[model samples]
Target: MNVRNFSVRRSVVATVAAVTALALAACSGGGSDADADKPSGPVTVKVWAWYPSFQKIVDLYNSTHTDIKIEWTNAGAGQDEYTKLQTALKAGKGAPDVVMLEFQELPTYQLTKHLVDMGKYGANDLKGQYVDWAWKQVSTGDKVYAIPVDAGPMAMLYREDLFKQYGLTIPKTWDEYKAQAEKLKTASAGKAFMTDFGGNDGGFMTGLMWQAGSKPYSYDTANPSNIGISVNDAGAKQVMTYWEGMVNSGLADTKAYGTTDFYNGLGSGKYVTYLAAGWGPGYLASVAKTTAGKWRAAPLPQWTAGGNAQGDWGGSSFAVTDQAKNPEAATKVAMEIYGAKNTDAWKIGIDEAYLFPTATPVLESDAFLKKKYDFFGGQTVNDVFVPAYKAILPFSWSPFNSYNFNQLTTGINGAIEKKTSWTAALDTAQANVTQYATQQGFKVQ
Candidate 1:
């Protein structure tokens, strides 16, 4: 998907304005002694979120509680949400009390001080409830800035019927996967092959690099001054090389079509497999209405023999802003809604079309795993995803992430579109990223 498409939606602007007005009005309530003694009369907390699943929880909360009603506004897409959030933070006045932040953007917002440290309101204990990697996204140094809401455990999704038609086995290693792609190409006589590379969305490349233990930056939380870039690291080079090979070999289609195109192509059996996350199953099921009962889920192929078995693509966190009139009360409600075990809420949310949960306990629940999904031929999709979640490697994310990665992807796109050498394009990307980092006051090691 395009970065702009992922940002918050504009539909929530009215909701935000309404909530802000309510908050201001609540503050202006008559200052009688009894009113002053009252513990902050029912502050209407404003929340901005993207996922329909999260909205379900909010709906549940609103249904159950008369006080502290949450006024929710949907930000268009993930990318749009971040843009709106950054703009609000820069404007510094009308930001929402709670904002949904993508995991990739967590470090950027946290480091830039756009987000409040959730721990300040006794919400620190909430960290213990999620997986280590999920919790690490909003953590910097000794401070916790956000609460993990969901995780995107990586997996390989494929058409079982297509694989059988091509007489191919599910490849376990990257090399084997490539060979299978080639064979499928030959079998289909150039009509079908492996997958599509979403040139517009650079997130797939970043996730692959992270899964291979490559990071864009390293820092010392104790010092809060030291920083190092890993764009030129060996792992990153390997990732780029692999991507280049895929494009050059014609095993993967390098198209600008966003997720919609990718899903449509997959559903029509235009490709054999896709490297995706836990939420992908539901997304594909919805989009590939005609391909039901033909697809299946499998473990991701390894880059090398016996390599790390896990990877992650995307996830999100919830943060309470410092500007909230009743930070304590808002957090109390947030924790109760997000931190507590709400299986029914989660199932309802997922059923209503939000992605899977990042909460480990929820993943382990029978209700989550045993659901009969008609997509993927009734296969237990959760079974494949849960294992992948355990394999993700935790790394410290930096504030310079979005800028650096965008530049790198832009350079890559230029190279492919202009027929430039990979090495030269990557070298240019490295220099550009380093310069951008320096301008942001980060050390480029």
Candidate 2:
């Protein structure tokens, strides 16, 4: 999803340094070993995480174990995290003993052999606990590279009051969604419309493509050489065209809203609809303090008239690095944090901070599904997204993913800004993706 443009700001540098210092201090402490049979020597395992909540999990691990202490380092945002990890791997020295990887980037890391094969450390024993799709992302050629920590199941967030005010029906198809957007724009006179088109983020495009049964690359396990490319495929073109039309018709705002602006825009009623995942409502609730009870959840508008395909936008996995001194202990700690029993705790944390859980049990829990989110007009938000978890198609992502997607998005956005034809823009995007993939040594068919 144009991962190259995603980055953590420089302001977080101080926070990262402080966290790293705390971790280093913990490493210095050689407390009573939890596993007396195992080696009691102090082992400091460096871990890289992009979010603050993971620090809590690290603390939990430290409290439970004495021999192995984890050093938590903030790796910035998704793209920044990958860049730093790549640099560390190349340098062969400062890389963390554990790295938090996004699902989209798992294949990239696996393909480049940047990550350790977890199966070597008994990861297969724990494979049964995770969902199939989640597990598939971290696997390559029978080698399980990582353990999934979270999943982002797509759903729709809308302004309930605005829908009622405009007398607009909840859309069931993309065409209906577009027509509603037009009506909403006309009704509100440009002050309110459908949603903010995140021109800079290709995540929407990716989700749409997956829902259309396409992937950036498809590799047949039976034949490793058979890699399939869906970059310029019909489904991709249709999705891009849909976005282009939205931008051109004045129903969508083409402003490049960063993370903060995105949440703020929803809170301030700058946008009436948000095509998002289960975590979106929680995120909006956290920031939209004043707009409580004004929002609601709905199903994503289908591309085909009655299609039920679903797709994910963002998710993450945890992997123990080969450099770790206590790899077994580290894997155990990761499993404990992501296990099903902890789903309630994870859901509570998500409710407090918008951190979605990947554990299947948590998503299906009645407590999670029944909770009435005041921000969403007391709608049962979880019910809308849980089903999408199983409906998403599995795809193999390439290491050069960010490069190709970012280039395609830039070209498409440029065309939109210049009032170029949608088809022409898509043709340019296809050519750009093809060239980029070829340059990266991926066979673009």
Candidate 3:
């Protein structure tokens, strides 16, 4: 699935002037019309996605369904695809029947009314099949915008050998985690930092803020022009301050993630722990092959002692675009493309592509939970991830996610370069996002 690339999905930020203009254009003139090119025969639903082995899944679907067929295309992944989708929306044409969208990016399209409400096509009836948090991600109140496909539940991936060598134990709380980071630095004689705080990755930083119970944004289609912004909330400040101290003291490195330096650090034993998500094991296995049996997965440290709150890093879904020639057929394709009922499709997704399932049947299957990995010395890593997945609290994303992430990336880079404090960085993000939202015609709450 190119899971590593998926894990490091980057934002495609437009300039404030361009974005504001696009928002105004999209809000007034795009995607609100009925399907204009309905076909007379068996429907061919055009789909844009980058899911691994998608052709096999499409073939399976085509072989069984006589009334509808999927015409799949990998337009691009993440930022590349988003840029194209935005352009298509602005032009009021050239969009596919359906498109794969990451959870965080869904709201941006929804704000422009470019995505269809799958609830009208019976998606609400399938809610019980998916994990609650995953369902929540594609829904707002009673509207279902997409179908849950996969999820990235957060956990701590550490070097077991290093933990033992440093006489350390898995931490149960963030305070204890900090103490252990300090201990690891001293024990390694400053040869290694505990982990890296990825300054350039807004998604990773957002996941950390989520784990700490930050409520950074709120927006809904019912009130598309109103948004609630609190990027500098107490929880966010606490998380940022915590990492800031660690980075400043050299207890944690501030390396940009997805770069060769960070990957090399993982393989070279320069980092003792990796705060990762459900798909992290596969990514680590692919990159740090030399550290095979030395790695192990564990629950993330709690902010409050004994708490089990968790956060997600990356996950995506299929949404029927408002430009679909046949909304019903497109909705069916979106809902069933990776559904629990499609075991053949899931075989390619889970077994071969290493996707973490959102469907409960697959997520809770004995085979999934009991499967062990040679990379983690045969540990049933799902045991750590399943709980993390189930424990995540509901989170709301802003419609201006691209600009929000850009602001965060700028602030984090400034902090990493010693030009500002992390707390100041977040405060700056809060101010910048609020102003941007207002500029885009949103009433900041």
Candidate 4:
């Protein structure tokens, strides 16, 4: 479920260098004490994001809307951004007018009361224009908090050339996938793995759990006190058990994905396929350029054959803060960027940023739907994801998602390193999560 990161390992690592000790600082309890800006002219809005080339879209919006100006900053990506923003929110200082958070992080922010309820500002009118699942993600219960911008429905990205060479059948179910893993392990003479294990990727494992019908975590945001978490539940146990076997048997590559070593494996025929998110193809193509035209994407293997039920990986949304000086104009800027299909910003978002669309207008647009890529052998890749986005079975994110993922990195990696039972790791993780939730004032069951 990780975005292919688009060379972000190099970039985000650099960001961490500059934003060093943010989490440590949070632990030590520090903040800038800077208040949110209240501008006198044109309602200057400070926006924070790490998306490269997003200024192009911002520029377009600024050109047409002279009454409001966007002051944008690339505040690093993922954890760094979240750390800085959360620190600001907690400190009541330097919070931007608008912020971008991953869908998973939305609930975490909401739990802390950091986001504004956009529904009161008339977000419901924007319904039917965005994907239902995505719109649902930014909301807790009946209150909307953010505008859905992009989605990352799960799909399988495979090396067609490698599959053909190995005489492997495209797997349609988990059983077939295991058989293919064994077949590929034998056929490649231990030179290639069927796919990567990536035990460090909690998002990927969470997506797998979603696909397996696992309700691992839930918290009632309305109350913020009632929480339910079951990482060792039967469904999750089934998924982890399967992967533990594959990894133990040496059928799956045990390397973390989106790394130089992993890409080297791909180039060297070490991994033939990857279960990646919708944003995967572009990121993979950017980094794995030499492997161009060798890959193809398909629906993820289902637990039940032919079932289209699925899970989402990574995606982001735009939220106006409760401290905005011009919430209406901020909404306008958001409307300009992602209001409808074929807008300049949305076009650039898909073409330049390579974010897969969950907005209806773009989803139904002929150009977007029929867009073909030479990287995919001229296949219209969006055609493959449209259904995946639609098929995503809805799931609720616990308010402790970032916390859960951060802990999971350690727990899951330990499982892989020790070659121990993932079920036991889940038990530990579940217990820790419950403890953390309770510490955060949630009533855990």
Candidate 5:
């Protein structure tokens, strides 16, 4: 998972704007000239991935394999790499054999038909090896476009000491959560908030909406040029209205996450709970050192009591691009780069990079689930997250996610600033995005 910059996985849709039908006309014959020569030796797969300390994984793969060699390059993170990839895709050359893409960004690339169908290379056989929701993110029906890597399953991190002091129990549902917010406010005399309603992060809010059973955007591989935009759908409005009330009631803080003020809020205990992803523990530990041992992890408050719905915030996958001269070699690299069998890669990802695994073997491993964190007072937070990961409902993303996120950020920020209603914001985003998609030659429904 890319660091959720508070919204660690910041993405941009400027590439979508550049991807006119005219540009795609030139993309039909795209393939890298780098692999024009068929070497007698091992096929060298050019890979573009932004994983930190990724060289360790590459070195391990290269050393242990004789038929394939990985030439790893950190092309840049998120939008930077995406912009470059889009440019290469348009030019019909220069793209790598494999590239790392965030789940939300996959459809945008897939819409251009630049991603290889990994199912042809036996990716479907490994379907049962990964978490279900993660596999769904990278595949649409029978076409597998990428291999799942790490995921950011949603969970709640709260101040255990604060909950105890306020005489509040962990909330089992959204209603209980709201009631607890009221109790926390009364007990603390308005000194602390239940949590901050971060209005500036579209990705974060998307996760919340996902938990509420919102499917704001949908694109079917069957109808590649058609999209479904329902940003103001009933489920989404339900979530928006809930948060709007919280902010209006002064029960939740209205600070943009990852800001200095927001960090201060967590550090000073101005916010009693953090609705965070699997990566939250490490981030919280770094920002709120003094609050160590005061925090504990728990399942996110369900929309319905005892419900199994879950959402994902940040996660990425390795995709084999269509430019690969050797699709089989590239597919092999994509699958095993972070495959379950690669213990060394898993160690680098989990222990060193603090990545939350998406592989079932890693997610269900006793070692991973039992690894205690000193920050959470020796609590095995994965115990909370692993189930959440497994329980996530399959989500679909639009091809214009970057644009969608931008509009959402604008709408949400406007709502928070008293210029609009949350539902109205969604309505505006719906109309604008629909118009934009139609203008881009898509049939927006």
Candidate 6:
């Protein structure tokens, strides 16, 4: 799965103005269950996913289950599938029975009440199969929204060699991180920078806010019209100020995410560290092997020196839509494909796909965790991830997170470009999102 793209934009449907067709389709109740025209026979399970790898997993399922036929389609990755799914859901015309959605994006489906409650279908029995944090991503208020597939818990991936070369120590807190950012630049004779501002990634920026103890957004079931948006809240502002200082100090490069320079910098040692997730190490290793044996993982630097909090960057799950005709079979396909605890399919999803698994058993599998690599000096990658995963702090994902991310990236990135304070950027983001929430029929405070 495209980690950078997935991490950059957490989740969302396309703008409603562009998807006005859904409003018209919803007028007719938009076929919430599978085809009003579907002929009665062996239920054909229609599944839509972005990754081609999923087709193999689906084939594995079809080989065994004769009752339901799994007709899987590689529906293009990321936003393309979501945009179409949203349109289909809105028009009540064309939607798959089983679909893959990022755990963060599950709230987008939930906000529209488009998801089937898998709990009613007895998803509880398989609850033990996944980490609680992963399960929570697929559920809200005791209602099961989907099945956990894969995950990415946030941590720091730094260049161990660079740290030693520059006489810098690993930062254990944000303040120390700032000091080291400046020190590293000076020590490296202006050749290497400490870290990037992670511009273009409001989700990662928001994760930073989460690390600093700020809940910038939330969705309340009772008040759907007006959601809670707090980008410029005191806590968030404080953290933004801290980052603003680093950017001003000329130590943190804000224009890093999605750029060619950023990727190249990883190999050149121009960039020292990054806040990454479970799937990050492999992706980094694949991209920048010149730094092989030089990189190591550590928990994200804390706001308080002794803090152990962590968060997710990218992860997704399988949701059986309310539109499914065969909820049980659909749910089974979802579970069986993701892994029924230590199943070969689960192993494939983790080891083969490099999904950064959320399946508890797969996560703890000796084969999965014990695999050492020359990438991090022959250390088991999981040694960094397991502790990072366990320290994951539960946080909120707003239905409007897609919009939230878009606006924040613009706001913060703009500030970094113009060399202004992040407080102003936070204000800009807050205003844009607040206006958007109001326009979307949500009451915003």
lDDT of 2 by residue, 283-314 (tens): 66766778888888888889879888888777
Question: For model 6, how does the per-residue alpha-carbon lDDT over 126-205 read when each residue is reduced to its tens digit?
Answer: 87776666677777666788887766777888999889999988888888888898899889878888877787776677
- Provide the lowest-lDDT 10-residue window in model 3: 1-10
Q: Give me the overall lDDT of model 3.
A: 0.83
Once superposed on the true structure, which residue ranges of model 6 sit more than 4 Å away at CA?
A: 1-3, 6-42, 340-342
Q: Put the candidates in lDDT order, highest first.
A: 5, 3, 4, 6, 1, 2
**The 10-residue segment with the lowest total lDDT in model 2:** 1-10
> What tens-digit string does per-residue lDDT give for candidate 1 at 68-148?
789998865665666666567555566787877777666555444445556767766766677777777777545777777
lDDT of 3 by residue, 286-369 (tens): 889999999999999998888988988888899988888788889999988888878778878876667888888887888789
RMSD (Å) per prediction: 6.4, 7.2, 2.2, 4.7, 2.3, 3.0
Error of 2 at 396 (Å): 2.0
lDDT of 2: 0.67
Per-residue lDDT of 86-149 in model 4, one digit per residue for the tens? 6677567778878888787776666556566667667777877876677788876668788888
Tens digits of per-residue lDDT, candidate 5, 74-121, equal 888777788888888777789999999989888877777788888988
Q: How many angstroms is residue 371 displaced in model 1 relative to the true structure, after the best TM-score fit?
A: 2.6
Maximum-lDDT candidate: 5
Off-target runs (Cα >4 Å) in candidate 2 are 1-43, 219-227, 259-264, 343-348, 443-445
The clash count for each model shown is 13, 1, 0, 2, 4, 8
Ranking by TM-score: 3, 5, 4, 6, 1, 2
CA error at residue 212 for candidate 5, angstroms: 0.9
